[model samples]
Structures are given as structure tokens and as C-alpha cells.
Target: MQGLVQSVFDKLLPPACPTYTGLLPLITTLLQDRSCFRAALSKGLGLGIVAAAGLIKLPQIVSIVTSRSSAGLSKTTFLVETFGHTYNLAAHVRQGYPPSTYGDFAALLVQNYVLLVLIYAYSGQPALGVSIVVGAVSLLGGMCNSGFPLGLLQTLTAGNVVLVFASRLPQALANYRAGSTGTLSAVTCVGMWLGATARIFTTLTEVDDPSILAGYVAAAVLNGIIAGQVLYYRGIKSRRGTQPSPAKKVQ
Candidate 1:
């Protein structure tokens, strides 16, 4: 049985697992000792978040494509949020934080751009979509190869509180006005809310960056607002469905 576990770990785990980067050592020693409990828990949860991130936005994407609508989604919100993630990812990488803490941002970044393009495409703005794709590729490629200043990355990440509001308020306001989240997927909203909250805990455990911690804190609050809207609107829908019909007049 031990050999089976080792075989599976060898095949499934990444090449860096043996490097004693604090994560694998924790896993290996978890039963042998009870030290670093918080670190172990954080690493486990962080990896779970990364694994879940790939499919976190998938339902929303599928819903938009199936309905041919981008009704409740805000393009600007996604665009700005993607920018925030890009800057955060850059900072974490340059600062040499563990990938477990920031890996989800990398995964979510790709998904966000895909969703953004779909939004533009369905909104009849193919040119805008193409422009965004080109801009992101050129900008990120250059930043990666060239010396992306850590100061700028930190500044951008520090401003993520404002970025969070910018990314969520418009969508929340739209939901308020429409009395519905429209085409927004409840699964995605709730998932993101949960993710943000979990990120706050994990960031505290694994990362020492104040900017990243603050961003996750703000994100948790804003994401809760959107998720609350989903539940609130859903309840309203359920109540309306149960409303009694008025009696018809005698003929």
C-alpha cells in the first residue's frame, strides 16, 4: 500500500515535489509530527484552490455560450479584474513566494481573458476583443522578458482595493437595476466568494505580502455582494413563481 501511494505520487506530483520547498516536507511529516499545522493546512488548501480554479469560471462560460448572451456580465469589470490579477501574479513571482499561494491567479487569468473575449464577441465587438487579446499578449510578453519593475507591480497590487470596487460595483449595480443577475451564473459567483475568503486565510498563512492580503480581503467582501445578489434574486424568483393568479370576471 505504501508503495502504491509512492507510485501514484511519483506519477502525479510535479517534478518540484522532492525539493523540500516546505510543502512536500509538511505532507511527509504531517503524521510523524504535529508541527506547522497552519502551514500544512494552508498548502493543502492552496493546492485545492489551484485545482478548482481551472473550472471555477467554466460554468459561467458555458452559460454565456449556450444562451448567446452576456447580459449580467460587465466587460469592464472583467478587464480590470484581469489586470489586477496579472499585476498580482507578477509581484508574487518576482518576490519568490510559493506557487501554492498565487497559482490560482495564473489559472484564473487565462479564464478571465477567455470570458472577456466571449463577452465582446457576443456583444458584437469582435474588434475590441481582438485588440484586447493583442494588447494583453504584447504587454505581458514584454513585461515577462524585460525587467518588470517590482515597485510598479507592488503599486498596482496595492491599488487592488480600488480595483475590486471597480470590478464589482458596476455589476452589482446592474443587478440591482435589473432585479436579476440576468445571465450571471450563481455557481461562479458563489465559487468566487468562497475562493476569496479562503484566499485571505491562505495568504495569511503562506504569504507575507500586505498588498496581496489586502486584495483578497477586499475581494471577499465584494464577491459576497455578488453572491448575495444571486441568492436574493433567486429567492425573489421562487416567490414569484408561487404567487396566486387573479380570478377572471364572469362572462
Candidate 2:
């Protein structure tokens, strides 16, 4: 049944290129029998939904780079995300598992790295200094494991989530209240939303760790809120555009 579902998802969204090729045989095998098709389709649909969510972050990413400003970008969220992924990596390492299993580690690494660069480009020394401090702490936590050290590492990991969510809440609320995303890039917002959605499904379908699942869910909700704000702002802008401006009185 699982195999059948995977096959359908493969057919609809179709894994990107080289990756999908490897699964092609498994997918084909399931399709050969009619009885398994429905189950396969169900699984495929779930995967598709996740895939759609993953695409949401693309818009936000593009917007930040193109505009060269972190205007609406929240440093705290990225900081928390970076720390969270770092902790996850440490946990995987401690358990003798590969880090890639978490998926978000790679995405977070890229997102946080690029964000730091963008922050530095616009905000300069202070931002860079903060990034350095956070990165240093994250690095130490991931590498060292001694008596009390292990406990400290675990704390850092847990703390990352708290800091990120706490930091993001205000910005999210501000965007929602203002009904304007301001300098926040539309591309990045969309991409982040999709990525977050995908991450949620990825947790549901792929990951097993309860802690990781919790983190992903938290991130997903935050991303969804941000996406909602951007979409709402766009709707308002569109409506205003359609409405005619009041006529000026004759001099």
C-alpha cells in the first residue's frame, strides 16, 4: 500500500530529475496492478501537498536577494531556525544517524547563511557580529560532548526553538496588523510558506522524532502566518488599484 501511494505521488509531482529516476522502478511496479492504484494515489496526493508547501519559500528567497535589503526579514526567526537545525544535527550525530535525515538542516543552513550575508550587506558590522556569535555557539554545541557539556548542548538545541518563535511572533503580528509586508520580499514569503508546508508533511510522512516534529510544526505555523499576511496585503493592494481615486475639485 505504501509503495502504491509513493508511486502515484511520483507520477503526479514526479520527483525532480535524478532522484525520481532511482524510484521509477518501484513506482512502475505498483502501477502494474489495478488493485493498488487507489492506495498509491492517496500516498501520492499527500506527497504532492507537501511538495506544494515546499515551493512557498521560493518567493521570499528571491525577494530578499533582489531587493538587497532585509527590511521585513526577522533576524530572530533566522537565528532560531539556525540554532534549531544545528541542535537537530547534534542530536543526529549523537545517535549515530546521518544529518540529512532531518532535511531541514540543509534548508536551514542555506537560509540562515544567505540571511546572514544579506544582513551584513545591508546592516553591516553589528549584524555580522551577532551572526558570528550565534554561529560560534551553534558550532560549539554541535561539536563538543563532555560530562555537563552534553546537557548544555541539549539546552542550546531546545533554546533555539524558543528564541526563534519568540522573536518571530512580533514581526508576524506587525505584518498582520499593518496589512503591508513593507520591504519583505514577496518571493521569499511565498517560498518560505511552501517550504514550511512541505516541511510539515515531511515530518508527518518521513521523520519519527517527537522533538523534531514539534519544531517543524512550530515553524510551519509561523510560516503560514507570514504567508497569510503577505497574501492579505496583496489582496488589499489589488482592491485599491481597482477602485477609482476620488476626483480632485475644480480650481
What tens-digit string does per-residue lDDT give for candidate 1 at 77-103?
A: 888888777777777877887788888
Q: Pick by TM-score: which candidate is best? A: 1
Name the runs in model 2 displaced over 4 angstroms. 1-25, 28-61, 97-100, 124-164, 204-206
For 1-251, candidate 2 gives per-residue lDDT tens digits of 76777575455542222123345664675668443444444345445543443453455556766876667666666665565656666665665532234444545455566566666567665567466657756584545454335556556555544654875686797786776876676665666656555655555544455656566567677767877787788889889999998999999
- As for candidate 1, its clashing pairs are none
lDDT of each: 0.82, 0.59
